[model samples]
Structure formats: C-alpha cells, structure tokens
Target: MLEIVAVPAFADNYLWLIHDPVSGETVAVDPGDSVPLLAEAERRGWPIGQVWNTHWHPDHSGGNEAVKQAGATVYAPASEAARIPGVDVALKEGDRVRIGEHQAEVWEVPGHTLGHIAYVLRDDGIAFVGDTLFAMGCGRLFEGTPQQMFESLQRIAALPADTRLYCAHEYTLSNARFAAAAEPANDAIAHRLKAVEQARQAGEMTVPTTVAEELQTNVFVRAHDPQDFARLRTSKDTFR
Candidate 1:
C-alpha cells in the first residue's frame, strides 16, 4: 500500500509526499520550495524519485532545480513546457504516471493556469488537485476564464465521492468563512467552518477533504450555471 504525508512548506502551502514502503521511493507534488522538501525527504530516508507539478506558478515550480539536481524526474504539463523549469516529462490528459506499484491518471484541469493538471491516484483514491479545487472554493481565474474553471471543477467533482482531495494550499478556513457568508444557511458549510477553526487553533492542517464534502460545502462548485458561477467568481475576486 502507498502512504501519503503532507509536508507544510511556506505559510499555507503543502507539498505532498507520497511513498511506497515496499519500494522505498517517494514522489513530491507541487514542491514550492526545495530546501524544505529535500530536508524532509532526507529526514525520512526516502529517495526522491519524481517531482509533479500541477501548474507553472512560482510557488509550485520553485523547487524544480533542487529536485532535478537530486536526480528526480520532473513532470509538468505539456502546454507549459517552456514555463516549468527542468520538466523532463510533459504530460497531458489521459496520460498515466507510475509511482512504484501505484499509478496516477493525468487530468488536464486548466483555469488556475492555462495548462494546470491534476494527478488522480487511482489505487489510493486521492486526487492531487493543486489550486483547481479548494476546500470550500476554487482557484482564482488568473489565466483562464470562469467557464474553463467551472468545467474544470465539474470534472474534478465528478470523480468518485470517496476520492481524497489533496490541494496545494491551506485555504480551508478562509474559504469556509467565505462559503458561510455566501450560503449562511448551509448546514455543511457551518459545520465545516467550526471544525476547521478548531483544527487551525490546534496547529493542524485541515486538508484531504473528500469530494463529497466539497460538493456539499463549496459554493463555487454548487453554483447552478456559468452565469451564476461567474457572478460568484467576481464576488470572490473583489472580496476582502
């Protein structure tokens, strides 16, 4: 079986470390910084085998050089080949990547970035959806349009309800607060907000939220149509 661990990087950023105990190999996802990831891998005595990037944001690709120097194969979206540093394998949707005995399917999810991609580990039932779908919200439309983002979220939400969501950032508490403001009467949102607050107060990371939880509490995903989704996106953009 594969084991997944979250390595807290800079404030709010999470670099997921997935390992295969039988093979003693580990792969890191969205390693925003190299020093911390390298140190953590060394601390755990696991050799870094692969580096996966969901997008070309600085915070997501900053550790490319370090990971590459350590002899890890870096995989990024084909559309962002020039943007991502040290991308050895450029993948698109329908592609598959092997991590020891486990494997992940490449899902081309743009909107946060033109070529943002999510890796859905079929065996482990976890989706490493960086910045695309958050706990109670989705990513800002920095590069793609709202329609693109909405479709992306739809694709992600269609995954198995049990699929664990491993997002790049720790925006659960803030997103849940905004969700509560948008849908004050939503029982799931209210319950999640209180639970998230407690988790934060205890210095814990409130992540790995299931697809089912997001569907129930995430306002952006629950929007009826593109128009409503766009309005919500605009409101979130202007929200303080």
Candidate 2:
C-alpha cells in the first residue's frame, strides 16, 4: 500500500507525496516547490525517487528541474511536454505508471489546461486530480471549452464512488459555499458546507474528499448537461 502524504505548498496548493514503505520508494505529485518537499522528505527519512506532473502550470511544475536534479525521474503529460521542463517520460491517456507493486492509470482530463491529466490508482482507491476536479467545484475553463471540462468531470465522476479524490488546492470551503448557493434545494450541499466551514475554522484540511461526496455536493459535477455545466462555470467564475 502507498502512504499518501499532503505536502502543503505555495498558498493553497498541495504537493502530494506518495510512499511505499515496503520498497522504500517515494514519489511526488505536482511538487510546485522543491524546498519544502525535499526538506520534508529528509525529515521523514523518505527519499523521493520520482516526480509526477499533472499539467504545465508553473505552480505545479516549477520544482521539476530541482527534483530531477536530485535523482528523481520526471513523468509529465505528453501533450504538455513543451510547457513542462525536465520530463524524463511523457505520458498520455491509458498509460500505466507503477511504483513498487502499486500501479495507476493515466487519464487525460483537459479544460483547466489543454493538456491536464489525472492519475487513478484504483488499487489504492485514490486519484491525484490536480486542478481538474476539486472537492466541491471544478477547474475553470482556461484553455478548453465548457464541454471539454464537463466531459472530463463526467468521466471522473463515473469512477468508483469509493475512490478518494486528492485535489491540488485547498479551495473546498469557498467551493462548498458556492454549491449551497447554486443548489438551494440540495440539503446535502448545505450540510456539507456547514461541516466544511467548521473544519476551516479549526484549521483543518478539507481535501481528499470522496467521489460520492462530490457527486452529492459539487455543483459542477451535479450539472445536468454540458450547457448546465457551462452556466455553472460562468456563475462560479464571477461568484463572490
């Protein structure tokens, strides 16, 4: 089993650290900064050997060069190779990534960025969804269309409900608030918002939310169709 650790970085971002104790192999997901990640790894005595990139965002790939310099093999999205630096392997949809005895499937989920992708480790019932799918919201239509993002979200939601989603940002509290406003009739969203607020007040992280939880509370994923999804995206873009 891979032990997943949340390494907080650059404001609200999360750089996940995946460790397999049996083999003593460690991997980093979206490590935006090298200082904290390397320090934390040394502090915990877990030497990271691989770096995985979900997209080309600087905040997600800024540390790729440094991490690779430390002997870590860099794996990044094939389509975004030109944007991401120091990639040793270029991955695409349906690709398989292995760490120790654990393996994960690669999913090409564009919309937030033209070449965004996510890693689904079904064996561990976990997914490292960068900015594509948040706890109670989806990514903005930065480089792709609403239909593209909607389709990506639909594909993610179709995964096992028990799958625990690991998003890269700590924006669940604000997203939950939007969910409540977007769907006033959804009691589930209201309840979730209450809990999220409490957690934030107590300085607790609200990420690693389950697919089932998002299905019930995320307004974007709950969108009935592509057009509905587009409306929600626009409203969320300007939601205050």
Using TM-score as the measure, the top candidate is 2
Question: After superposing candidate 2, which stretches have Cα over 4 Å from the reference?
Answer: none
Worst 10 residues of 2 by lDDT: 1-10
Q: Rate the local accuracy (lDDT) of all candidates.
A: 0.91, 0.93
Q: Tens-digit lDDT track for model 2 on 1-240?
A: 778999899899999999999889999999899999998888899888999999999999999999888889999999999999899999999999988999989999999999999999998999999999999998888899999999999999999999999999999988998898999999999999999999999999998999999899998998999999999999999999
How does residue 222 of candidate 1 score in lDDT?
Answer: 95
**Model 2: residue 181 alpha-carbon error in angstroms:** 0.5
| Top model number, lDDT | 2
Q: Per model, state how many residue pairs clash.
A: 0, 0
Error of 2 at 135 (Å): 0.5
TM-score of each prediction: 0.98, 0.99
Residue-wise C-alpha lDDT for candidate 1, range 1-240, written one tens digit per residue: 888888888878999889999888899898889998999889998889999999999899999889889979999999998998999999999999988888899999889899999999877888999999998989999899888998999989998999999998899888888899899999989999999999999998889888999899999989897788899989887776
What would you estimate as the lDDT of candidate 1? 0.91
